[model samples]
Target: MVVQESGTPRELEHHLRPSTVKGIDFDQLLEPLAATAHGAANKRPITGVSLNPQIVQPGDVFLAISGAKRHGAEFLDTAIANGAVALITDEAGLNLLAEPASIPVAVVSDVRKIAARAASMVYGTAKNCPELLAVTGTNGKTTTTFMIRAITEALGLHAGLVGTIEMSARGQIIPSVLTTPEATQLHGVLARMNEQEISTVAMEVSSHSLSYGRVDGLQFAVSGYTNLTQDHLDLHGSMEDYFQTKAQLFTSGHSQRAVVMVDDSYGQRLAQNASIPTESLSLDAHTNADWHVVNIAPSVLGHQFTIVHRDGREIHARTGLPGLFNVANAALATVMVLASGVALEQLQEALKQADPLSVSVPGRMQVIGESPVAVVDFAHNSDAIAKALESMRVTGQGRRIIVFGATGDRDKTKRPDMGAVAARHADIVIVTDDDPHGEDPEPIREQVAAGAQAVIDAERAAVQLFNIAPRAKAVEFAVSLAGVQDAILVAGRGHEVSQDVAGIDVELDDRVELANALKLHGFVTIY
Candidate 1:
């Protein structure tokens, strides 16, 4: 697979840790390990924590977890060579270690479970963590977190963000490697935010993070659920498994309260069964939710809507981003802040004055052109593709044109579904390569194209389909074929800067490619 790194191993290691750390007693930090201590390990102070042996540094406790291919004890020598002072691992890892090891060792039954707690103790984040607000689901996690950060900022609070696109602490942005970072990096980032005096944090909690104990030690002030759909089946194996993984974030252990969207069955089930005080939100006024959206009308910015509470409270809001889904995201953000104890009157004032919901999220319905209106979005899955295309529908003579492709080596079952969604929504569909990591590009394209072709043949649909490789050419072709009144959507890999093709990184940014193509086609380009 094409492995993308944010930086060199050493640089990334340094970047993940906070600049300043208060050393903690190793024995005290090991209290949460829940295992007997072995070896000649003393109660020395530890300055940092890391799970990666390549990034281990002096005074750091290295966590060795077993992997599918190899045990982490295999890298014990490398971690020690890089200056790891102590080791935390399972019995399997301890058994693999050589006799008479130099450093101290602690053996746990499950390393992943206690890794976050240990890191939190070492980084001093468990007690000093900022007001944490989190969102988890198949989609809308990133946008909702961004919206939460925006609203928090509008209220004159310094807010930090951790999500799919990037992580930020008081406006210092760092490109993120995962939707939710590993426990070591997560605690370190939280420590840094605390050091910077950031009062609130909006983070996207992914299913993988929840399932893997990445967020084990975090107790969110408020957590939210958007919706679950057919994405990441490769990881979870089934939709039910994916739902359960996301459900972990809403329990009393993980969050104090919850704001759940009951528009879908999964959401409905979650809200009903969540082991915490939960507030239900729905676009349907008749759904009997704690919060309901009404008076949705298109505006110059986007759609203006009103959030109505069951207790006769009302807040008017608007989002600059298009689509009904964005409206849901904005409403979710508003209620999450309200749940965090922001007064309704104060939040309404902030919405009226600052319009925090109007903030633009990177690569999410990001507009690159005014004429032949072009957009770059991260809509790789079937549900997201349908929503994106529906939102970009043209009026009168304008046609909806879409250029997208399936991500390789990920949920191969969704490829055909994504194509079918495109064929049903767009008048023209151009299938291109998107991150063909370790998988042949052509076979992936054929599967997607086959789905589109099936729809065209079965229903006699008047949809035009094209299979193009090397995404840049596909974008160019879409722009060339579009009319001034048409709208073109370059979907999938929204803000990603590089394409993974058979273990090689081919540089490509959708916004830049789309903007360049629009200019080449004599169309008006937007920033």
Candidate 2:
């Protein structure tokens, strides 16, 4: 599927608005924007809202904000030609408008925030939204949100999901371009979910979404924190700034309650300073957290563990996905739902009957073969890469092989660390290209290889390293070199089907490539 352009309204053509929202007075729908503007007399009813000028429809209120490269007001002609009835913009945007504007314009200090508030009002999500659950972190956000949705469904309630992989309302599944949708599209999804009688929603809230005001004007019923690490420093610039951006979600304005994992220092700090009522979770039994995971044992699929509360209560649960991190994900999902007001006993029974925690999350520790144990995951960062490789380790003489690469135009600082982690964990490491968006792929691969080479030299390890290209060849090489007992991991790109290379779109799916490579080697694949 073609990835939609950023900020484009998606999955809203036929399902977003109900008949009741056919028209709403501009002043009523966007009172916040009108209250601060100069010419606000246009009282035309707004039937829709849009941020992208290309998708503007008749009777829509176009939101024009100041962008990094160009102001949204620069596209006023396009928005008007496409049928925008009114406009909401900042002073900078207002200055760009002609003296006699074709449409009524409302100026706001922050157009993005106003757009979210206006969308909420227009879509009836400001007051009638479903039980909102959100998870935010550097890693595990996707899996935790997916687990929340699974648990919600296991309890026999309709659930909607908006995350990195896809957005779903009722049965309509739309491919996701952003980890969190733009506010206008987000409110539209919530409204559609409300219309579909979905009682709950699970969403992945990225740091970019929170920093860019994509999740503004929304309140989550229960928000969750997994862990924060060295990633996204490209945008945030520093770890402190990144943590502060994520910290915004734990405040009273964003969520009513929170379930925070106190494993990392960031989570510990967030739990200590969070404004809302927060519940602490930890895998360490010694820590006096509200919830704890104990009695963990390896299972055929993954691991089974008990989620024990400090108040002498516990629920048994299991996950089909491997890795101790997945066990943390399952425990976090359980507590997040529990914090949302579900009875412990009822949740336990639903978990037992449905096995919701075992639900497959696309591209996340996704296993494709049994012999040689081929797997694909989205472990791009150092911490995630370390954990992923550790989880794939077996007791005997099975060599662990990893095929991975760092993304270009991202936090370049993490590239070496990711390589070092792979070298430390795997017997053989294959460095390859992973979506070198707008950057030269060779340098990116070299930097990663340099890190791995440093580790091999310093430790005098017996690990073999190879730098490959185009990704498909890397997977093929890994499979060819693997024995029946050895494991192969294709990391960095998981469920993604396309690669962005130097502004060009290239078709690629790691799972498909790995499966084909295994089949060519006469190895049995799980699928």
Candidate 3:
């Protein structure tokens, strides 16, 4: 049920012109090239895309983006060596391109959106795609995006997904490195999806992508919001800034119908303020939303819930996933399908009988094999941490041993808050490492320790507190401390396979370590 629009085909070649580059666009939007001028080829029509220079094929465009710690364009020589035809860059990369290379260099006004639009045009825009739905918010965005993709495919639609965990089509698997990719990469992905005859795409829309113009130019048939929380304060500067970025997806005129979860105030505000007609969902009764969940019940098996639309349409839904939070996620997915014009009866059947999706959303809430339920979840922010800890507490039959760490260089303010929550909730607190980046491990440990200490009674603080600066060592020590009757929670580095220490990514996984530790302790159970 895509909203039919009368328009010309959106073209990539049409938007890649040199005349439209803006400074702010260059600073915030464009992806800087990873290639250096040392080996750049002559400017030509790019038929392919690559971030890495070595893998760049001839006649392909090389995108140089400034990443979390370094500029991507610093690898221009490598890009040129592999046969890059053109370059999309920002002002800073001009110095690198001082001497002309073989390729045509186009300075973009805003790299993010421009690149996305360019890729769409080159790869084939919304016209080529069956339909596109972008899911945005602070938490559960990745899960909801994947859920929608799963439901779509389950209903016999060929679906493609792009989110934090991975990217996939009917038959190929590509590991996901970013929650949302750059404009060119995104467009290229859609292009590939079009080639695969994928009728739909469900993707996560990060605040960074919206603010940086990473998702510009393409129109979304249905765009949905999960919930906003206290994450990414380091980049957005404040909660208001974060909300504004998320709001852009609904209001920036890219989406047709907005599906928002009005469980929180932010979602309520978005529903009331959005330009398009919004489908609002609620986990609790306060929202009085367009799409509402009633008779909600949670159990160890999963969630049994009912969805009520404003027109008296009802859907009795169930999901294998646990927690009340996931109900909101499921409801959001249901509404996205409804918004896309799937029949209510179909939505109900899909909800009730959809096969248990084999999605390994790395850190969402990964269960480590053992009794007492050792779990690893990617709950770094205060809101997510609180939710993860509480979910673990409610689901388990024994005392909880929570192990976590705050990143070294991120929003330092959240450290104490996270510590306070962990201290008040968990029976045991094992403070550990999570991507210290350039910051010293000790200070990060101290900050989290300070947080936990602030909430704990002074008399018991010393006994409950333990610090292990390196993540693997911290996990090892924590795992050793747990017994079969106690649940050990390894939070923060949920699905990640590496730890960034002193600028190098070192291998580490909570699941792998926990498995070995369980086997080492000589615990055997087929269950």
Candidate 4:
């Protein structure tokens, strides 16, 4: 039974974004798993696939897989109630079900492996698209993916993008919840990309997505490894596990080839052990790599560097994104484009002429002002915050004022570390909220402030502490403190449009608020 509601074409697209397929035999679909389909609704024709119970429709199959915090078996009843034609789940979920289920069930030993395959069959295979480029790492995944899309577009090719900030195919873009989308949405986005005539796609593949089976069955044309760092320990438990999860992208069946940045020890290990053919990349010109950035110039406008190729040829490249880290990001993107089979001469020339603003990632080191310089960056972790502050410190001959906060319900250990980093690098540190999620904002701020207070006696001294509840007020407070030659750093929640207060994402854009503050302070007239 199809439920049709009258609406505009745009409304219809949002509702029916996931393409539906039918006429496939329900039991036959489970042949891939060798599981017997049993229930009152065994022979129903499947029309679509879904993971979330609320989104399941008539003739849709639900995959009840385990998660980091909870088991999907708990939601079996919800899924069945939401018109799930059948359930494709592990033995644990099967045990949760009674002997006679309201719907058919496909019991599998590994639900992750089949979930994406089933999604692909219902919508379409994303592999049929022209090219799929996946970039994975702790940082720079979003920036690099945007770069790939920009470079491809400059070369007169239509490109699609999927990453931390948003998902875009053609001209349409939507804010992203995960660095990599869920398996169902990932395949659906790929299908939409093909429909929109997007020739090339660059996506971010996060460790959580890889570990949680969110990107189970998708293959990439070429995967680029950005440097991994110490983060996400609450989920991965250890740095070794984090590195291994990232390495999955470079394995035999995942990517065709790899462009590994050997700037860090982990990258060195990944390049050496990559199952597929790999090319080593480096930001340090002296480091031996197939591609390296030498003769670098870092400015307020970003870095201008010459990329030395394997043949000793140099490509003069410049990105307006700023910082030395961005040079590495641009270089990695250059190699990824090369791995995609774009002609070397074309890529080199295009890179030399690449407009930084065209590929500018929204919140990663975005400068919103000129005089009394202010910057907004998504430097949530300790290392990232330190790097952002240091980058600004090196560039400006001024006092650095920092406004940032720790995300609630995340790695609690990094709280003090972030505080220590801010206290060490920033002249003035203002602690505020960054996505409190389900945790109390006050306690989260205290942990970060405690860390900062331990390292430096800023509370009683020059470093200012403001217990601002609302994020916009924090930005206003930081702006108020800005004097001549003083550069302010707004860390955490870069390019993010909402602040996760309590449980809901209240509309709060850093750039929007920062730009407003800059304008009020008479820093920039045109936002």
Best by TM-score: 1
Clash totals in order: 0, 0, 33, 1
TM-score of 1: 0.96
lDDT of 1 by residue, 1-527 (tens): 21333666667666566787778877777776676778886666898888889888778998999989998888989888988888888888888876856888888898888889888888888788899999988889989999999999899998999988888876577779899999989998898888888999999999999988999888999999999999888889999999988998888889999999999999999999999999999998778689999999997637999999889899999998978999999999999999999999999999999989989887898889867778999998999999988888475799999999998899998898888889999999999999999999999999999998888888647899999988999999999999888999999988899999889889999999999999998988876
lDDT of 3 by residue, 1-527 (tens): 32222222222221222212111221122234332333433434556555556556555666666567766567777788777666676666655664775565656444443456555545655466658898998888877887888789778789888888767777555656678876767776776677668888898989988887878877898999988888888899999989988888886578998899988899889999998878888877766788788887764525778888788988887665655777778788878988998997886676556642324456676666557567778778877777776766424446677889899788889898888888877878889888899999888888998888877865345447788756667776776776677777788877788888999989998778766766666653222
Off-target runs (Cα >4 Å) in candidate 1 are 1-7
Off by over 4 Å in 3: 1-45, 49-55, 62-78, 87-100, 105-113, 356-360, 393-397, 458-463, 483-485, 522-527
Give me the runs in candidate 4 sitting further than 4 Å from their true place. Answer: 1-23, 40-44, 66-83, 95-102, 298-300, 352-358, 393-397, 457-468
Q: For model 1, how many clashes? A: 0
- Report the Cα lDDT for candidate 3: 0.72
Candidates sorted on TM-score, descending: 1, 2, 4, 3
* Residues 216-260 of candidate 2: C-alpha lDDT, one tens digit per residue: 888999999999999999999999999999999999989999999
lDDT of 4 by residue, 67-142 (tens): 7777676787777776777888887777876565777777888777777777777666644554899999888888
RMSD of each predicted structure: 2.8, 2.5, 7.7, 4.2
User: Regarding lDDT, does 2 or 3 come out ahead?
Assistant: 2
User: Which candidate should be chosen as best, given lDDT against the real structure?
Assistant: 1
